[model samples]
Target: MKTADIQPFFATLKAANPSPQTELEYTSVFELLAAVLLSAQATDVGVNKATRKLFPVANTPQAILALGLESLEGYIKTIGLFRSKAKHLMETCRILVERHDGQVPDTREALEALPGVGRKTANVVLNVAFGQPTMAVDTHIFRVSNRTGLAPGKNPLEVEKQLMRRVPGDYAVDSHHWLILLGRYVCQARKPRCWECLVSSYCDYSPKTPPPQGSLR
Candidate 1:
């Protein structure tokens, strides 16, 4: 996408939803960290469902550590890879308690050092929790970035970097949220609803998909 187009592209998205936010539900930074850690290969709705039951009981790292692996698994077993997620959560809690005073780390390096945390997770934590203008390209964001020619790249890291560079400073903070929502709902993988997409004008995709024939909503 051209530099001039990029501003309007993000501007349209920002206009649609002035205050975009992550769909994953959380109260404290610890809860957000745990939710993101568990969100890999899972939907936000699914993660929120599990966390809704888990948070009240163990919202803190120390509390989750005390919850024990077995009980923790019981709470999140409905989520995919729950067993491994539970294990990672337990070890992460231990590390947080032992190293960081049971608090979620703000820096990428420290966040990535946790058992289940990775570059994407660290980026998300840094962005959502600390209000950093970081991009965490997941499957949805990746697809949208490429399909829209906003920041096409071969991998998540590349796309993230491209987004960091291409996105306007004004939209940098909430761009991830906007792209994620757009991909999840409008620019879907199976069949993009380009007809209703707000930024379709700026999108570089050819043969934009129209709404179902002879139907209007």
Candidate 2:
């Protein structure tokens, strides 16, 4: 997309959903961090399903550690890579309790130091929990950025850099959420629902797909 179209593109998204939020359900910063950690290759729905059950039982770092590794694994066993994710969560909880007094760290350096927390996970926590303008380039964001010519790049890090530099300041903090939602629901990977896309006019993709037969606009 052109530099000029960027403003209206995000403006439209904001108008449609003024306050976008992560699909992952969490009541606290630690819960958000844990949910993101468990969501590596899992869907938000799956993560939420597990967290809904787990958080009430063990929401805090100390509480999670008290649950023991086996119980933690049992709670999240439905998710993909549960064993490894549970181990990472256990290790991360230990670090949080021992080093940070059981509180979720705000700095990127501190957040990334946890065993399961990568740049992407750190970005999610920083953006959603701390209101930072960091972009967490997940599969949806990556696909939307490349497909719309908004911030095309070869990798997540490259795409993240592009978005940080290109997105307007007013929209930066929430742009990742908007893009993720757009990609998840409209600009889909297998076949984009261009016919119903609200911002398709500003998208760089050509030959937009038509509505399916008998489907109403």
Candidate 3:
């Protein structure tokens, strides 16, 4: 997209949501970390549902560590790959307690060192928990970036780098949330709701999907 169009694209998003936040529910950094870890291959709503029951019992790393693998699995078994996620969480808690004093690390390197925490998860923690201007290009962000030509790339890393370089500095901090929300609710993968999209004029997607039959324009 052109530089002129880019500014308005983000401006529209900013005007729509002055302050955006992750859908995942968590009270502390530790809970946020745990929630993100469990969110892999699962919906935020699903992860939130599991964490709702899990956090009250054990929000801290040490507390979660004490839950043991079997008990922990019981709490998150509703989520896909619960067994593996439980194991990674168990090991991650152990590393946190032993290394960083049980606090979620703010640095990408230390955060990614955890078993279940990859670059994307690390980026999320850094951005949401530490208030860093990092772009964690999940499926939603990836789709929106490419579809809108805001930062098209073949993969998440490429798209992420492009976003960091292309996104206006003023909007960088919240761009991640905005793009994700746009893709999840508006520019969906199957059928984008271009008719009511706030930034549809700036999008590069061709043949924008019209409103459904019998729906008001």
Best by lDDT: 2
Global fold similarity of model 1 (TM-score): 0.98
lDDT winner between candidates 2 and 3: 2
Cα-based RMSD of candidate 1 = 0.9
Model 2 collision count: 0
Separate clash counts for every candidate: 0, 0, 0
Tens digit of lDDT per residue, candidate 3, span 1-217? 7878999999999999999999999999999999999999999999999999999998998899888889999999999999999999999999999999988888999998999999999999999999999999999999999988999999999999999999999999899999999999998898899998999999899888888899889
Candidate 1: stretches off by over 4 Å: none
Tens-place lDDT per residue, model 2, 1-217, is 9999999999999999999999999999999999999999999999999999999999999999999999999999999999999999999999999999999999999999999999999999999999999999999999999989999999999999999999999999999999999999999999999999999999988889999999997
The reply for model 3, stretches above 4 Å from the true place, is none
Writing each residue's lDDT as its tens digit, candidate 1 over 142-204 gives 999999898999999999999998998999899999999999999999999998899999999
Candidate 2: where are CA atoms >4 Å away?
none
Per-residue lDDT, model 3, residue 49, is 91
lDDT (C-alpha, whole model) for all candidates: 0.93, 0.97, 0.93
